[model samples]
Target: MEIVTGMKKITFGVFLLLLLSSFKLEASNYTFGVRIVGKGKPMILIPGLKGSADTYNDVVAHYKDHYTCYVITLAGFAGQPASAELNHPLKGQRDEIIRYIIEKRLHKPVLVGFSFGGTLAIWIASTRPDLIGALIELDGVPFDAGIEKNHVNMDSIRRDARFRNEKIIDAQADYWQHVDSVRHTKKFREQGFLDMKELVTDTTRINQILDWDDLSDYKASRLMVNEMNSLDLRDSVSKISSPILVLGSWKGWVNFKTKETVAARYQKQYSPADKVTIVFSENGKHFLMYDDFNWMIGEMDKFLKSI
Candidate 1:
Protein backbone atom coordinates (compact mmCIF):
# COMPACT_ATOMS: atom_id res chain seq x y z
CA MET A 1 0.00 0.00 0.00
CA GLU A 2 2.85 2.43 0.81
CA ILE A 3 4.56 1.85 -2.57
CA VAL A 4 1.21 2.26 -4.45
CA THR A 5 0.51 5.59 -2.67
CA GLY A 6 3.99 6.84 -3.55
CA MET A 7 3.45 5.95 -7.20
CA LYS A 8 0.11 7.78 -7.24
CA LYS A 9 1.71 10.89 -5.72
CA ILE A 10 4.45 10.92 -8.39
CA THR A 11 1.88 10.52 -11.17
CA PHE A 12 -0.21 13.40 -9.83
CA GLY A 13 2.79 15.69 -9.65
CA VAL A 14 3.76 14.93 -13.24
CA PHE A 15 0.23 15.59 -14.45
CA LEU A 16 0.11 18.89 -12.60
CA LEU A 17 3.37 19.99 -14.19
CA LEU A 18 2.13 19.14 -17.65
CA LEU A 19 -1.10 21.06 -17.05
CA LEU A 20 0.81 24.14 -15.93
CA SER A 21 3.09 23.99 -18.97
CA SER A 22 0.13 23.81 -21.31
CA PHE A 23 -1.50 26.80 -19.63
CA LYS A 24 1.67 28.87 -20.00
CA LEU A 25 1.99 28.01 -23.67
CA GLU A 26 -1.63 28.93 -24.37
CA ALA A 27 -1.22 32.26 -22.57
CA SER A 28 1.85 33.11 -24.66
CA ASN A 29 0.20 32.47 -28.00
CA TYR A 30 -2.43 34.93 -29.27
CA THR A 31 -4.49 35.52 -32.40
CA PHE A 32 -3.82 37.99 -35.27
CA GLY A 33 -0.54 36.26 -36.13
CA VAL A 34 0.89 37.93 -33.03
CA ARG A 35 2.28 36.36 -29.88
CA ILE A 36 1.84 37.96 -26.47
CA VAL A 37 3.11 36.76 -23.12
CA GLY A 38 2.45 39.35 -20.45
CA LYS A 39 -0.59 41.25 -19.35
CA GLY A 40 -0.58 44.92 -20.26
CA LYS A 41 -1.90 47.31 -22.89
CA PRO A 42 -1.39 45.72 -26.32
CA MET A 43 1.15 47.11 -28.80
CA ILE A 44 1.08 46.74 -32.60
CA LEU A 45 4.26 46.77 -34.67
CA ILE A 46 4.54 48.02 -38.25
CA PRO A 47 7.63 46.84 -40.15
CA GLY A 48 10.07 48.66 -42.47
CA LEU A 49 10.42 48.98 -46.25
CA LYS A 50 10.83 45.70 -48.13
CA GLY A 51 10.10 44.11 -44.76
CA SER A 52 7.84 41.38 -43.37
CA ALA A 53 6.55 39.97 -40.08
CA ASP A 54 9.67 37.85 -39.96
CA THR A 55 11.69 41.06 -39.74
CA TYR A 56 10.26 41.65 -36.26
CA ASN A 57 11.45 38.28 -34.98
CA ASP A 58 14.27 39.80 -32.95
CA VAL A 59 12.22 42.76 -31.79
CA VAL A 60 9.40 40.48 -30.71
CA ALA A 61 11.74 38.20 -28.77
CA HIS A 62 12.99 41.24 -26.88
CA TYR A 63 9.53 42.57 -25.97
CA LYS A 64 7.53 39.34 -25.58
CA ASP A 65 8.13 39.09 -21.84
CA HIS A 66 6.69 42.57 -21.31
CA TYR A 67 3.72 43.51 -23.49
CA THR A 68 0.95 41.96 -25.54
CA CYS A 69 2.66 42.39 -28.90
CA TYR A 70 1.09 42.40 -32.34
CA VAL A 71 3.51 42.34 -35.27
CA ILE A 72 1.79 43.22 -38.56
CA THR A 73 3.13 42.65 -42.09
CA LEU A 74 1.63 45.20 -44.43
CA ALA A 75 0.09 44.08 -47.72
CA GLY A 76 1.91 44.08 -51.10
CA PHE A 77 5.35 44.56 -49.60
CA ALA A 78 5.84 41.38 -47.65
CA GLY A 79 4.56 37.84 -48.26
CA GLN A 80 1.00 38.77 -47.24
CA PRO A 81 -1.54 38.63 -50.07
CA ALA A 82 -4.55 40.88 -50.46
CA SER A 83 -8.00 39.44 -51.17
CA ALA A 84 -8.75 42.51 -53.28
CA GLU A 85 -6.46 44.55 -55.49
CA LEU A 86 -3.31 46.27 -54.10
CA ASN A 87 -4.91 49.39 -55.55
CA HIS A 88 -4.63 51.43 -52.38
CA PRO A 89 -1.44 53.17 -51.40
CA LEU A 90 -0.50 54.44 -47.95
CA LYS A 91 -3.93 55.77 -47.11
CA GLY A 92 -5.46 52.48 -48.10
CA GLN A 93 -3.02 50.68 -45.84
CA ARG A 94 -4.03 53.00 -43.00
CA ASP A 95 -7.71 52.31 -43.62
CA GLU A 96 -7.08 48.57 -43.56
CA ILE A 97 -5.32 48.92 -40.20
CA ILE A 98 -8.20 51.00 -38.89
CA ARG A 99 -10.68 48.41 -40.03
CA TYR A 100 -8.63 45.72 -38.33
CA ILE A 101 -8.66 47.63 -35.07
CA ILE A 102 -12.41 48.12 -35.26
CA GLU A 103 -13.07 44.52 -36.18
CA LYS A 104 -10.76 43.16 -33.52
CA ARG A 105 -11.86 45.83 -31.05
CA LEU A 106 -8.28 46.40 -30.03
CA HIS A 107 -8.63 48.98 -27.29
CA LYS A 108 -6.34 51.97 -27.62
CA PRO A 109 -3.48 49.81 -28.90
CA VAL A 110 -0.10 51.54 -28.97
CA LEU A 111 0.98 51.84 -32.60
CA VAL A 112 4.69 51.51 -33.46
CA GLY A 113 6.12 52.05 -36.94
CA PHE A 114 9.64 51.60 -38.29
CA SER A 115 11.11 53.38 -41.36
CA PHE A 116 8.57 53.51 -44.23
CA GLY A 117 6.13 51.90 -41.84
CA GLY A 118 6.69 54.98 -39.69
CA THR A 119 4.99 57.17 -42.28
CA LEU A 120 1.94 54.90 -42.25
CA ALA A 121 1.67 55.10 -38.45
CA ILE A 122 1.77 58.89 -38.61
CA TRP A 123 -0.96 58.94 -41.22
CA ILE A 124 -3.13 56.78 -38.95
CA ALA A 125 -2.47 58.91 -35.87
CA SER A 126 -3.08 62.11 -37.84
CA THR A 127 -6.30 60.89 -39.44
CA ARG A 128 -7.57 58.47 -36.80
CA PRO A 129 -6.14 59.81 -33.59
CA ASP A 130 -9.04 58.38 -31.61
CA LEU A 131 -8.01 54.81 -32.43
CA ILE A 132 -4.54 55.15 -30.94
CA GLY A 133 -3.64 55.51 -27.27
CA ALA A 134 0.02 56.36 -27.98
CA LEU A 135 2.31 56.49 -31.03
CA ILE A 136 5.94 55.37 -31.41
CA GLU A 137 7.85 56.63 -34.42
CA LEU A 138 11.05 54.74 -35.28
CA ASP A 139 13.24 57.12 -37.26
CA GLY A 140 10.30 58.40 -39.32
CA VAL A 141 9.11 62.01 -39.56
CA PRO A 142 6.54 63.77 -41.73
CA PHE A 143 7.33 65.16 -45.16
CA ASP A 144 7.94 68.88 -45.50
CA ALA A 145 4.86 70.66 -46.77
CA GLY A 146 5.08 73.01 -49.79
CA ILE A 147 5.01 73.00 -53.58
CA GLU A 148 8.14 75.07 -54.17
CA LYS A 149 10.65 73.17 -52.06
CA ASN A 150 8.89 69.81 -52.39
CA HIS A 151 8.06 70.03 -56.10
CA VAL A 152 8.90 66.97 -58.16
CA ASN A 153 10.45 66.81 -61.60
CA MET A 154 7.66 64.73 -63.14
CA ASP A 155 9.83 63.89 -66.13
CA SER A 156 12.47 62.36 -63.86
CA ILE A 157 9.81 60.55 -61.81
CA ARG A 158 8.21 59.23 -65.00
CA ARG A 159 11.56 58.00 -66.22
CA ASP A 160 12.24 56.25 -62.88
CA ALA A 161 8.84 54.60 -62.42
CA ARG A 162 9.53 50.84 -62.23
CA PHE A 163 5.94 49.69 -61.75
CA ARG A 164 4.25 51.19 -64.77
CA ASN A 165 1.71 48.53 -65.83
CA GLU A 166 3.93 45.80 -64.45
CA LYS A 167 2.30 42.54 -63.35
CA ILE A 168 2.59 41.64 -59.66
CA ILE A 169 4.58 38.39 -59.98
CA ASP A 170 6.88 39.87 -62.62
CA ALA A 171 7.51 42.97 -60.49
CA GLN A 172 8.13 40.99 -57.30
CA ALA A 173 10.37 38.50 -59.08
CA ASP A 174 12.35 41.39 -60.52
CA TYR A 175 12.49 43.10 -57.13
CA TRP A 176 13.80 39.99 -55.38
CA GLN A 177 16.16 39.31 -58.25
CA HIS A 178 17.54 42.80 -57.77
CA VAL A 179 17.75 42.13 -54.04
CA ASP A 180 19.63 38.87 -54.66
CA SER A 181 21.89 40.58 -57.17
CA VAL A 182 22.63 43.45 -54.82
CA ARG A 183 23.54 40.99 -52.06
CA HIS A 184 26.60 39.96 -54.08
CA THR A 185 27.80 43.54 -54.61
CA LYS A 186 31.00 44.55 -52.81
CA LYS A 187 29.17 47.20 -50.76
CA PHE A 188 26.38 44.87 -49.56
CA ARG A 189 28.76 41.96 -49.01
CA GLU A 190 30.82 44.17 -46.71
CA GLN A 191 27.74 45.25 -44.71
CA GLY A 192 26.26 41.76 -43.95
CA PHE A 193 22.69 43.08 -44.04
CA LEU A 194 21.31 40.83 -46.77
CA ASP A 195 18.59 38.26 -46.04
CA MET A 196 19.36 34.54 -46.17
CA LYS A 197 21.02 32.92 -49.19
CA GLU A 198 18.35 30.25 -49.51
CA LEU A 199 14.84 31.66 -49.38
CA VAL A 200 12.41 28.84 -48.48
CA THR A 201 9.43 30.60 -49.99
CA ASP A 202 9.43 32.53 -53.21
CA THR A 203 8.22 35.98 -52.01
CA THR A 204 7.30 36.91 -55.57
CA ARG A 205 3.93 35.24 -55.00
CA ILE A 206 2.58 38.44 -53.40
CA ASN A 207 2.70 40.45 -56.63
CA GLN A 208 -0.31 38.63 -58.02
CA ILE A 209 -2.72 40.74 -55.95
CA LEU A 210 -1.39 44.13 -56.99
CA ASP A 211 -3.35 46.35 -59.42
CA TRP A 212 -0.82 48.77 -60.88
CA ASP A 213 -3.41 50.44 -63.09
CA ASP A 214 -5.41 51.54 -60.08
CA LEU A 215 -4.46 55.20 -59.63
CA SER A 216 -6.19 55.08 -56.27
CA ASP A 217 -3.59 52.55 -55.20
CA TYR A 218 -0.56 54.39 -56.53
CA LYS A 219 -1.52 58.04 -55.93
CA ALA A 220 -1.00 58.53 -52.17
CA SER A 221 2.14 56.41 -51.61
CA ARG A 222 3.82 57.95 -54.68
CA LEU A 223 2.91 61.45 -53.56
CA MET A 224 4.08 60.78 -50.02
CA VAL A 225 7.45 59.39 -51.14
CA ASN A 226 7.89 62.34 -53.51
CA GLU A 227 7.11 64.85 -50.80
CA MET A 228 9.35 63.01 -48.36
CA ASN A 229 12.36 63.16 -50.70
CA SER A 230 11.77 66.84 -51.47
CA LEU A 231 10.79 68.35 -48.11
CA ASP A 232 12.24 68.48 -44.61
CA LEU A 233 9.85 67.93 -41.68
CA ARG A 234 11.94 70.08 -39.32
CA ASP A 235 9.80 73.20 -39.75
CA SER A 236 6.50 71.38 -39.34
CA VAL A 237 7.16 69.28 -36.21
CA SER A 238 4.96 71.57 -34.16
CA LYS A 239 1.90 70.69 -36.24
CA ILE A 240 1.78 67.05 -35.12
CA SER A 241 -0.55 66.72 -32.11
CA SER A 242 0.48 63.27 -30.94
CA PRO A 243 3.47 62.84 -28.67
CA ILE A 244 6.31 61.99 -31.07
CA LEU A 245 9.51 60.06 -30.41
CA VAL A 246 12.11 60.53 -33.14
CA LEU A 247 15.14 58.27 -33.68
CA GLY A 248 17.97 58.79 -36.17
CA SER A 249 20.65 56.48 -37.54
CA TRP A 250 24.31 57.38 -37.56
CA LYS A 251 24.90 55.89 -41.02
CA GLY A 252 23.17 56.01 -44.38
CA TRP A 253 22.55 52.91 -46.53
CA VAL A 254 23.67 54.15 -49.93
CA ASN A 255 27.15 55.36 -50.85
CA PHE A 256 27.75 58.98 -49.98
CA LYS A 257 30.94 60.98 -50.40
CA THR A 258 31.10 60.66 -46.60
CA LYS A 259 28.65 58.84 -44.29
CA GLU A 260 29.32 61.31 -41.48
CA THR A 261 28.32 64.15 -43.76
CA VAL A 262 25.08 62.36 -44.68
CA ALA A 263 24.29 61.46 -41.08
CA ALA A 264 24.90 64.99 -39.87
CA ARG A 265 22.77 66.41 -42.66
CA TYR A 266 19.96 63.96 -41.86
CA GLN A 267 20.16 64.64 -38.11
CA LYS A 268 20.00 68.40 -38.62
CA GLN A 269 17.17 67.99 -41.12
CA TYR A 270 14.71 66.26 -38.71
CA SER A 271 15.61 67.43 -35.20
CA PRO A 272 12.46 67.57 -33.04
CA ALA A 273 11.47 70.12 -30.37
CA ASP A 274 10.63 70.01 -26.62
CA LYS A 275 7.24 68.41 -27.19
CA VAL A 276 9.02 65.60 -28.98
CA THR A 277 11.86 63.58 -27.46
CA ILE A 278 14.49 62.35 -29.91
CA VAL A 279 16.87 59.43 -29.38
CA PHE A 280 19.96 58.79 -31.46
CA SER A 281 21.88 55.53 -31.71
CA GLU A 282 25.34 56.52 -32.94
CA ASN A 283 26.06 53.09 -34.47
CA GLY A 284 22.76 52.74 -36.35
CA LYS A 285 21.77 53.17 -40.01
CA HIS A 286 18.42 53.95 -41.70
CA PHE A 287 17.07 50.67 -40.37
CA LEU A 288 17.85 51.73 -36.83
CA MET A 289 15.65 49.06 -35.22
CA TYR A 290 17.72 46.24 -36.69
CA ASP A 291 21.00 48.17 -36.38
CA ASP A 292 20.48 48.89 -32.67
CA PHE A 293 17.98 46.27 -31.51
CA ASN A 294 18.65 46.21 -27.79
CA TRP A 295 18.87 49.99 -27.53
CA MET A 296 15.63 50.40 -29.46
CA ILE A 297 13.90 47.68 -27.43
CA GLY A 298 14.98 49.34 -24.19
CA GLU A 299 13.94 52.77 -25.45
CA MET A 300 10.57 51.44 -26.58
CA ASP A 301 9.98 49.65 -23.29
CA LYS A 302 10.85 52.79 -21.35
CA PHE A 303 8.60 54.94 -23.51
CA LEU A 304 5.68 52.49 -23.41
CA LYS A 305 5.95 52.08 -19.67
CA SER A 306 6.01 55.82 -19.05
CA ILE A 307 2.96 56.29 -21.21
Candidate 2:
Protein backbone atom coordinates (compact mmCIF):
# COMPACT_ATOMS: atom_id res chain seq x y z
CA MET A 1 0.00 0.00 0.00
CA GLU A 2 3.06 2.30 -0.22
CA ILE A 3 2.06 3.39 -3.73
CA VAL A 4 -1.47 4.26 -2.53
CA THR A 5 -0.04 6.32 0.36
CA GLY A 6 2.23 8.17 -2.12
CA MET A 7 -0.78 9.10 -4.27
CA LYS A 8 -2.68 10.38 -1.23
CA LYS A 9 0.28 12.58 -0.22
CA ILE A 10 0.51 14.04 -3.73
CA THR A 11 -3.21 14.83 -3.75
CA PHE A 12 -2.90 16.50 -0.36
CA GLY A 13 -0.01 18.63 -1.60
CA VAL A 14 -2.08 19.77 -4.59
CA PHE A 15 -4.97 20.67 -2.29
CA LEU A 16 -2.61 22.71 -0.09
CA LEU A 17 -1.26 24.54 -3.15
CA LEU A 18 -4.76 25.46 -4.29
CA LEU A 19 -5.68 26.64 -0.79
CA LEU A 20 -2.66 28.93 -0.69
CA SER A 21 -3.50 30.33 -4.12
CA SER A 22 -7.06 31.09 -3.04
CA PHE A 23 -5.81 32.89 0.10
CA LYS A 24 -3.45 35.02 -1.95
CA LEU A 25 -6.23 36.02 -4.30
CA GLU A 26 -8.47 36.97 -1.39
CA ALA A 27 -5.73 39.01 0.23
CA SER A 28 -4.99 40.93 -2.94
CA ASN A 29 -8.64 41.76 -3.48
CA TYR A 30 -9.02 42.88 0.13
CA THR A 31 -5.88 45.00 0.07
CA PHE A 32 -7.12 46.95 -2.95
CA GLY A 33 -10.71 47.17 -1.70
CA VAL A 34 -11.98 45.87 -5.01
CA ARG A 35 -15.65 44.93 -5.31
CA ILE A 36 -16.54 42.91 -8.39
CA VAL A 37 -20.00 42.42 -9.81
CA GLY A 38 -21.87 41.22 -12.93
CA LYS A 39 -20.51 38.82 -15.54
CA GLY A 40 -19.15 39.26 -19.05
CA LYS A 41 -16.11 41.10 -20.33
CA PRO A 42 -14.08 42.85 -17.63
CA MET A 43 -14.63 46.56 -16.95
CA ILE A 44 -12.62 48.41 -14.29
CA LEU A 45 -13.89 51.61 -12.69
CA ILE A 46 -11.81 53.91 -10.52
CA PRO A 47 -13.51 56.63 -8.54
CA GLY A 48 -12.38 60.22 -7.88
CA LEU A 49 -10.50 61.53 -4.81
CA LYS A 50 -12.31 60.92 -1.54
CA GLY A 51 -14.76 58.89 -3.60
CA SER A 52 -15.64 55.23 -3.11
CA ALA A 53 -16.59 52.36 -5.38
CA ASP A 54 -20.21 53.23 -4.53
CA THR A 55 -19.77 56.32 -6.70
CA TYR A 56 -19.92 54.06 -9.77
CA ASN A 57 -23.16 52.32 -8.72
CA ASP A 58 -25.12 53.93 -11.49
CA VAL A 59 -22.60 53.05 -14.16
CA VAL A 60 -22.26 49.49 -12.87
CA ALA A 61 -26.04 49.13 -12.85
CA HIS A 62 -26.22 50.16 -16.49
CA TYR A 63 -23.41 47.90 -17.71
CA LYS A 64 -23.70 45.00 -15.26
CA ASP A 65 -25.80 42.90 -17.60
CA HIS A 66 -23.11 42.93 -20.26
CA TYR A 67 -19.85 43.41 -18.35
CA THR A 68 -18.20 42.19 -15.18
CA CYS A 69 -17.48 45.41 -13.27
CA TYR A 70 -14.44 45.75 -11.03
CA VAL A 71 -14.98 48.80 -8.85
CA ILE A 72 -11.91 49.86 -6.86
CA THR A 73 -11.76 52.23 -3.89
CA LEU A 74 -8.13 52.79 -3.12
CA ALA A 75 -6.81 52.08 0.35
CA GLY A 76 -7.40 54.86 2.90
CA PHE A 77 -10.18 56.52 0.89
CA ALA A 78 -13.90 56.34 1.60
CA GLY A 79 -13.38 54.88 5.11
CA GLN A 80 -10.94 52.24 3.91
CA PRO A 81 -7.81 51.62 5.98
CA ALA A 82 -4.63 53.45 5.02
CA SER A 83 -1.43 51.72 3.99
CA ALA A 84 1.53 52.87 6.08
CA GLU A 85 4.04 51.75 3.47
CA LEU A 86 2.60 53.86 0.66
CA ASN A 87 4.22 57.28 0.63
CA HIS A 88 3.10 57.91 -2.93
CA PRO A 89 -0.37 56.40 -2.74
CA LEU A 90 -1.42 57.14 -6.32
CA LYS A 91 1.63 55.41 -7.75
CA GLY A 92 1.03 52.53 -5.39
CA GLN A 93 -2.55 52.39 -6.62
CA ARG A 94 -1.39 52.23 -10.24
CA ASP A 95 1.01 49.40 -9.48
CA GLU A 96 -1.58 47.46 -7.50
CA ILE A 97 -4.13 47.85 -10.29
CA ILE A 98 -1.67 46.53 -12.83
CA ARG A 99 -0.91 43.56 -10.57
CA TYR A 100 -4.61 42.91 -10.09
CA ILE A 101 -5.22 42.90 -13.84
CA ILE A 102 -2.35 40.50 -14.34
CA GLU A 103 -3.32 38.15 -11.52
CA LYS A 104 -6.92 37.99 -12.72
CA ARG A 105 -5.82 37.41 -16.33
CA LEU A 106 -8.06 40.18 -17.59
CA HIS A 107 -7.94 40.57 -21.37
CA LYS A 108 -7.17 44.24 -21.85
CA PRO A 109 -10.38 45.38 -20.20
CA VAL A 110 -11.86 48.86 -20.46
CA LEU A 111 -10.61 51.22 -17.75
CA VAL A 112 -12.81 54.16 -16.68
CA GLY A 113 -11.62 56.72 -14.14
CA PHE A 114 -12.99 59.99 -12.76
CA SER A 115 -11.17 63.07 -11.48
CA PHE A 116 -8.04 61.96 -9.58
CA GLY A 117 -8.79 58.37 -10.47
CA GLY A 118 -8.82 59.43 -14.11
CA THR A 119 -5.32 60.77 -13.66
CA LEU A 120 -4.23 57.39 -12.29
CA ALA A 121 -5.91 55.71 -15.25
CA ILE A 122 -3.98 57.92 -17.65
CA TRP A 123 -0.72 57.06 -15.95
CA ILE A 124 -1.54 53.34 -16.08
CA ALA A 125 -2.52 53.47 -19.73
CA SER A 126 0.64 55.35 -20.60
CA THR A 127 2.98 53.20 -18.53
CA ARG A 128 1.24 49.84 -19.00
CA PRO A 129 -0.61 50.18 -22.27
CA ASP A 130 -0.83 46.43 -22.78
CA LEU A 131 -2.98 46.01 -19.66
CA ILE A 132 -5.96 47.95 -20.89
CA GLY A 133 -8.13 47.69 -24.02
CA ALA A 134 -9.66 51.20 -23.82
CA LEU A 135 -9.54 54.19 -21.48
CA ILE A 136 -12.17 56.78 -20.46
CA GLU A 137 -11.10 59.90 -18.56
CA LEU A 138 -13.91 61.86 -16.90
CA ASP A 139 -12.66 65.43 -16.35
CA GLY A 140 -8.96 64.46 -15.94
CA VAL A 141 -6.03 65.80 -17.91
CA PRO A 142 -2.43 64.77 -18.35
CA PHE A 143 -0.71 67.88 -17.02
CA ASP A 144 -1.16 70.10 -14.01
CA ALA A 145 -2.34 73.60 -15.03
CA GLY A 146 -0.30 75.33 -12.34
CA ILE A 147 2.93 73.50 -13.15
CA GLU A 148 2.35 73.94 -16.89
CA LYS A 149 1.66 77.69 -16.65
CA ASN A 150 4.75 78.30 -14.49
CA HIS A 151 6.92 76.19 -16.79
CA VAL A 152 8.55 74.60 -13.77
CA ASN A 153 11.59 72.46 -14.48
CA MET A 154 12.13 69.01 -13.05
CA ASP A 155 14.20 70.34 -10.13
CA SER A 156 11.47 72.77 -9.12
CA ILE A 157 8.87 70.05 -9.47
CA ARG A 158 10.90 67.85 -7.11
CA ARG A 159 11.32 70.74 -4.66
CA ASP A 160 7.60 71.55 -4.71
CA ALA A 161 6.67 67.91 -4.24
CA ARG A 162 9.05 67.66 -1.29
CA PHE A 163 7.60 70.81 0.27
CA ARG A 164 4.10 69.46 -0.12
CA ASN A 165 5.12 66.13 1.32
CA GLU A 166 6.61 67.86 4.34
CA LYS A 167 3.39 69.75 4.95
CA ILE A 168 1.19 66.64 4.66
CA ILE A 169 1.10 66.01 8.40
CA ASP A 170 -0.24 69.49 9.12
CA ALA A 171 -2.63 69.29 6.19
CA GLN A 172 -3.96 65.99 7.41
CA ALA A 173 -4.53 67.39 10.89
CA ASP A 174 -6.30 70.46 9.53
CA TYR A 175 -8.44 68.37 7.19
CA TRP A 176 -9.45 65.99 9.96
CA GLN A 177 -10.39 68.96 12.10
CA HIS A 178 -12.57 70.28 9.34
CA VAL A 179 -14.13 66.88 8.86
CA ASP A 180 -14.86 66.67 12.56
CA SER A 181 -16.45 70.11 12.53
CA VAL A 182 -18.68 69.20 9.62
CA ARG A 183 -19.67 65.98 11.30
CA HIS A 184 -20.38 67.33 14.78
CA THR A 185 -21.26 71.01 14.62
CA LYS A 186 -24.42 72.49 13.12
CA LYS A 187 -22.74 75.94 13.07
CA PHE A 188 -20.11 74.65 10.64
CA ARG A 189 -22.83 73.31 8.37
CA GLU A 190 -24.60 76.69 8.45
CA GLN A 191 -21.36 78.41 7.46
CA GLY A 192 -21.58 76.77 4.02
CA PHE A 193 -18.84 74.30 4.78
CA LEU A 194 -19.76 71.84 2.02
CA ASP A 195 -20.49 72.73 -1.58
CA MET A 196 -23.92 71.37 -2.40
CA LYS A 197 -23.84 72.31 -6.07
CA GLU A 198 -21.28 69.62 -6.79
CA LEU A 199 -23.61 66.93 -5.52
CA VAL A 200 -26.36 65.38 -7.60
CA THR A 201 -30.06 65.47 -6.65
CA ASP A 202 -30.42 61.71 -6.34
CA THR A 203 -30.99 60.40 -2.82
CA THR A 204 -28.69 57.46 -3.35
CA ARG A 205 -25.89 59.72 -4.51
CA ILE A 206 -26.45 62.05 -1.58
CA ASN A 207 -26.38 59.18 0.88
CA GLN A 208 -23.22 57.79 -0.62
CA ILE A 209 -21.54 61.19 -0.37
CA LEU A 210 -22.66 61.51 3.21
CA ASP A 211 -21.20 58.12 4.05
CA TRP A 212 -17.96 58.98 2.28
CA ASP A 213 -17.70 62.41 3.88
CA ASP A 214 -18.02 60.84 7.30
CA LEU A 215 -15.32 58.21 6.76
CA SER A 216 -12.81 59.60 4.25
CA ASP A 217 -9.21 59.28 5.34
CA TYR A 218 -7.67 62.77 5.06
CA LYS A 219 -4.11 61.44 5.10
CA ALA A 220 -4.67 59.46 1.92
CA SER A 221 -6.35 62.42 0.22
CA ARG A 222 -3.40 64.67 1.02
CA LEU A 223 -0.88 62.17 -0.37
CA MET A 224 -2.92 61.79 -3.56
CA VAL A 225 -3.25 65.55 -4.09
CA ASN A 226 0.44 66.14 -3.42
CA GLU A 227 1.37 63.67 -6.15
CA MET A 228 -1.36 64.83 -8.54
CA ASN A 229 -0.49 68.53 -8.27
CA SER A 230 3.16 67.82 -9.08
CA LEU A 231 2.59 65.32 -11.92
CA ASP A 232 3.25 66.11 -15.61
CA LEU A 233 1.82 63.60 -18.05
CA ARG A 234 2.42 65.51 -21.30
CA ASP A 235 5.24 63.17 -22.34
CA SER A 236 3.26 60.05 -21.47
CA VAL A 237 0.11 60.78 -23.50
CA SER A 238 1.79 59.84 -26.78
CA LYS A 239 2.87 56.48 -25.35
CA ILE A 240 -0.70 55.22 -24.98
CA SER A 241 -1.99 53.13 -27.90
CA SER A 242 -5.43 52.08 -26.67
CA PRO A 243 -8.59 53.95 -27.61
CA ILE A 244 -9.09 57.02 -25.39
CA LEU A 245 -12.31 58.89 -24.65
CA VAL A 246 -11.98 62.13 -22.69
CA LEU A 247 -15.25 63.60 -21.41
CA GLY A 248 -14.40 67.22 -20.62
CA SER A 249 -16.39 69.68 -18.55
CA TRP A 250 -17.55 72.98 -19.98
CA LYS A 251 -18.63 74.55 -16.69
CA GLY A 252 -15.33 75.52 -15.17
CA TRP A 253 -14.86 75.64 -11.44
CA VAL A 254 -11.87 77.54 -9.92
CA ASN A 255 -9.80 79.27 -12.62
CA PHE A 256 -11.57 78.45 -15.86
CA LYS A 257 -14.10 81.10 -17.03
CA THR A 258 -15.92 79.83 -20.10
CA LYS A 259 -16.78 76.63 -21.95
CA GLU A 260 -14.85 77.69 -25.05
CA THR A 261 -11.71 78.27 -22.96
CA VAL A 262 -12.02 74.87 -21.26
CA ALA A 263 -12.64 73.12 -24.56
CA ALA A 264 -9.69 74.86 -26.16
CA ARG A 265 -7.38 73.86 -23.32
CA TYR A 266 -8.27 70.15 -23.65
CA GLN A 267 -8.04 70.33 -27.42
CA LYS A 268 -4.51 71.63 -27.09
CA GLN A 269 -3.43 69.26 -24.30
CA TYR A 270 -4.71 66.03 -25.86
CA SER A 271 -3.95 66.97 -29.49
CA PRO A 272 -0.86 64.72 -29.47
CA ALA A 273 -2.96 61.55 -29.41
CA ASP A 274 -3.26 59.46 -32.59
CA LYS A 275 -6.39 57.65 -31.36
CA VAL A 276 -8.27 59.93 -28.99
CA THR A 277 -11.84 61.26 -28.94
CA ILE A 278 -12.78 64.36 -26.95
CA VAL A 279 -16.39 65.12 -26.00
CA PHE A 280 -17.29 68.39 -24.34
CA SER A 281 -20.33 68.41 -22.06
CA GLU A 282 -22.23 71.68 -22.17
CA ASN A 283 -23.73 71.32 -18.69
CA GLY A 284 -21.31 68.86 -17.09
CA LYS A 285 -19.35 69.99 -14.09
CA HIS A 286 -16.26 68.16 -12.88
CA PHE A 287 -18.48 65.18 -12.12
CA LEU A 288 -19.73 64.76 -15.66
CA MET A 289 -21.01 61.21 -15.15
CA TYR A 290 -23.42 62.30 -12.43
CA ASP A 291 -24.15 65.78 -13.77
CA ASP A 292 -25.03 64.62 -17.27
CA PHE A 293 -25.94 60.99 -16.75
CA ASN A 294 -27.94 60.30 -19.88
CA TRP A 295 -25.45 61.95 -22.24
CA MET A 296 -22.45 60.38 -20.51
CA ILE A 297 -24.10 56.94 -20.57
CA GLY A 298 -24.93 57.25 -24.26
CA GLU A 299 -21.39 58.31 -25.11
CA MET A 300 -19.87 55.54 -22.98
CA ASP A 301 -22.13 52.89 -24.56
CA LYS A 302 -21.28 54.05 -28.05
CA PHE A 303 -17.56 54.19 -27.24
CA LEU A 304 -17.56 50.72 -25.66
CA LYS A 305 -19.36 49.26 -28.66
CA SER A 306 -16.99 50.98 -31.06
CA ILE A 307 -13.91 49.82 -29.21
lDDT of 2: 0.78
Q: Please give each candidate's TM-score.
A: 0.58, 0.83
Candidate 1 residue-wise lDDT, 1-307, digit = tens: 1223444644666767778999777533321133344455677888755456665677777777766777876544444433243333444667777877777688988888886777677667666766777778776656422212335464554444434423332455566557556644666543432332121122232221111112112223344354334433455544446566666553433444454654454455445433456676666555555556778778877876676
Per-prediction tally of clashes: 2, 0
Best by TM-score: 2
Quote the positional error of residue 294 for candidate 2 in Å: 0.6
lDDT of candidate 2 at residue 300, scale 0 to 100: 93
C-alpha lDDT of candidate 1 relative to the true structure: 0.55
Overall lDDT per candidate, in order of appearance:
0.55, 0.78
Worst 10 residues of 1 by lDDT: 207-216
- As a whole number from 0 to 100, the lDDT of residue 1 in candidate 1 is 14
Q: Over all chains combined, what TM-score does candidate 1 have?
A: 0.58
Clash count, predicted structure 1: 2
